[model samples]
Target: MKYSYYALFTTNNQGRIEVTFPDLAPHVATFGNNLPDAQRMAADALVGYLLTAESLGIKLPQPSSFQDLTPDSQQRLIPIEVDTKSN
Candidate 1:
């Protein structure tokens, strides 16, 4: 199965790109030194979250529409996709 979600990328005070999935949970977060790295980490984080939820027999939440998100200047909304079958 393929899962898609929007992640918020924010540059923290430490200059690291912090990634968070608002549609998921507050505890779901990842970080990287740069944009590219952050994107990769975001995808990995999303996959891990989804897989873990599946393994625990928990229902996943529906993703929010991109248009509905309002990101500030310090944050960017990015789409992340993961295929469980490939993992």
Candidate 2:
């Protein structure tokens, strides 16, 4: 199954990119040194989160629409896609 979710990327004071899935658990987060790296990490995190939830039979919340999300100036809303079968 393929899942789509939004990742909130924010630049911290130390200049690192912090990524989080707002619709998911608050503890479900990842970070990287830069945008590209952060994006990769976000995808990996999303995949792991979904896989774990599936194995545990936990129901995940529906993804919020991109238009409905509001990211601040220091943050960006990015869409992430993951396929459980491929993983």
Candidate 3:
């Protein structure tokens, strides 16, 4: 919470977003076809990540930038598997 540790990004090539938390290891969530959805998912994911880390006795780090997660800027390709249930 001390740092602007959220990466908000939406790629035009595909309808999806990439959210990265620089503080926590393997802290990434991708499950959206757009920015808004991704942000929501990211928020939920972050809370869950923190809770899990706390239980595992891990200290979550805070980063001013997402440099650790990427070279210049970070981007992720999120594959969405849609399950359709119709009768």
Candidate 4:
């Protein structure tokens, strides 16, 4: 199955990109060296999170619309795709 989620991407002082998913509470954030790396890291983070949620019988929350999110100067909303089938 394919899952869609809104991710918040931010650039830290260290120049690493930080990714967070607001809809998933107690969620883990990941960092990458750059944009493309950050995006890939986000995908891995989501997959690992979801797999753990599944193993624990935790139902994943429905994703919020990308348009509904408000990002500050340090953050931006990004649409991400997760394919559980491949996991």
Candidate 4 residue pairs that clash? none
Write model 3 residue lDDT over 1-87, tens digit each, in one string: 221345545454565665655444366554567766876676566666655666788775654443444434456523222111210
Candidate 2 vs candidate 4: the lDDT winner is 2
TM per model? 0.95, 0.95, 0.57, 0.91
The CA lDDT at 34 in model 3 is 77
lDDT of 2 by residue, 1-87 (tens): 899999999999999999999899595799999999999999999999889999999988999998888989989999999999998
Candidate 2 deviant stretches above 4 angstroms = none
Full candidate order by TM-score, most accurate first:
2, 1, 4, 3
Displacement of the residue 51 alpha carbon in candidate 4, Å: 1.0
Name the lDDT of candidate 4.
0.86
lDDT comparison, 3 vs 4, better candidate: 4
Model 3: lDDT to the true structure: 0.52
Runs in model 1 deviating more than 4 A are none
Q: How well is each residue in 1-87 modelled by candidate 1, as lDDT tens digits?
A: 899999999999999999999999685799999999999999998898888988999888899998888999989999999998899
For model 4, what is the alpha-carbon lDDT of residue 12? Answer: 93
Measured with C-alpha atoms, the lDDT of residue 14 in candidate 2 is: 97
Q: Candidate 2: what lDDT?
A: 0.92
